[model samples]
Target: MVSTALQDLFGGKAAEAVLLALFHHGEAYGRSIARDFAVSLDSVQRQLDRFERSGTLVCKRQGRTLVYTWNSKSRLASRLRDLTGVVYDGLDPQTKEQLFAERRQPRAKDKPVIRR
Candidate 1:
């Protein structure tokens, strides 16, 4: 039973591709997601429905478009977001260090008089 569940979780390549697409871009509609994988809308919607049922993705309605994004409440999705953060940090050590060294560099608020 455990092996079967594990296989179900990791076996779907389409789901992984869809998640990667949404992870790189915050939110996307069905058509945009379909275009990312070069798949039909029906196939994309099917995968999205499965993800939604599994609680790994969530959808919101915006005008005529139904936008889908990673569900923050899902443990898997949260871990993926954390992994992305670590990857970004590792990609730019200097930038990460500088940002951590100074959270936000404040500028002088006073305005100086300009002399012609």
Candidate 2:
């Protein structure tokens, strides 16, 4: 039987994608997550809002964009990050590759782009 663990863990596939984007990259915005997952921006934004309200995430204004990251000060957020890490560790390589195709997002002003 095909396990629906991912959807069960995240409540929905779209929500899982949004969380995984943040987990993989440490931060993300609604539009970027939605575009990466091919889900609607509104759906991603709703998930973001839900997480933010639950104290699992915090968002700061980067100009007009609201960038979300785990709420470091909250223990619940920390535990959730750890859980997400475990789930991420179990994802197949192909799934990770596709979900994280774009690592680029609009940088905050004056954020230096480091080249390898």
Candidate 3:
């Protein structure tokens, strides 16, 4: 998987996943990120914590959830985002599609199907 190459380069799969999520979505909480990648919450939280501690990311509490985003002040932030963008672009079409398949709304009840 192209993502595995990112994992190898970034140290851990969880960290890579978190980075990609942040790069693609701008900000996200640990659980949502884990759910997106089908990874363990603990692993995602661990990577989030590590990035926060290292100043690679920053978090702000929003109601009950802590939303994490890239630390723009960090010297490495832009470079890292660029690298992740390259990796994201290299991903296979199906994986790229799944990465952004999160639903933003529910289908209308009893709606009729439309075919092209």
Candidate 4:
């Protein structure tokens, strides 16, 4: 099971999930993050709204999805990312596996696939 350390530190599950998702993926949207982390959509969205309002995050529209990412322009952006890294690195291996399960986006038309 994923540890509750992040949730305790962040004060809520949704906030922990949002920060970790963005930290892991570089960007996130409500539905995707919630689905990935088992957080409720409403909870994830509310945390997104709060972060955006606090200048900790920014939002942009990509097609129909409202994507959120860390606000690079914010003075605390780097610090926040570093803190996320610290938290992530502290997680148990099993928790890390559960948290970072695959969720790939579709490739653009005619885009080349890169096999690892």
Off by over 4 Å in 2: 1-4, 105-116
lDDT of 1 by residue, 1-116 (tens): 01222225547545544654465556766777666545577867788788788887899999988888889889987886566444443434443332233212254565321111
Task: Please give, for residues 24-105, the per-residue lDDT of candidate 3 as tens digits.
Answer: 7789899988888888999999999998998889999999999998899998877888888887777766776677667433
Ranking by lDDT: 4, 3, 2, 1
Residue 52 of candidate 2: its Cα lDDT? 96
Q: What TM-score does structure 4 among the candidates reach?
A: 0.82
The C-alpha lDDT values of all candidates are: 0.57, 0.78, 0.79, 0.82
Q: List the residue pairs that clash in candidate 2.
A: none
Off by over 4 Å in 1: 1-13, 80-116
**Model 3: residue 92 alpha-carbon error in angstroms:** 2.5
TM-score for model 3? 0.82
Q: Is candidate 1 or candidate 3 better by TM-score?
A: 3
Per-model TM-score, in order, reads 0.56, 0.82, 0.82, 0.82
lDDT for 70 in candidate 4 is: 90
Candidate 2, residues 16-88, lDDT tens digits: the string is: 8766788888889998888878888988899899999999999999999999999999999898888877878
Better of 1 and 4 by lDDT: 4
Please tell me which model should have the higher TM-score, number 1 or number 4: 4
Poorest stretch of ten by lDDT in candidate 2: 107-116
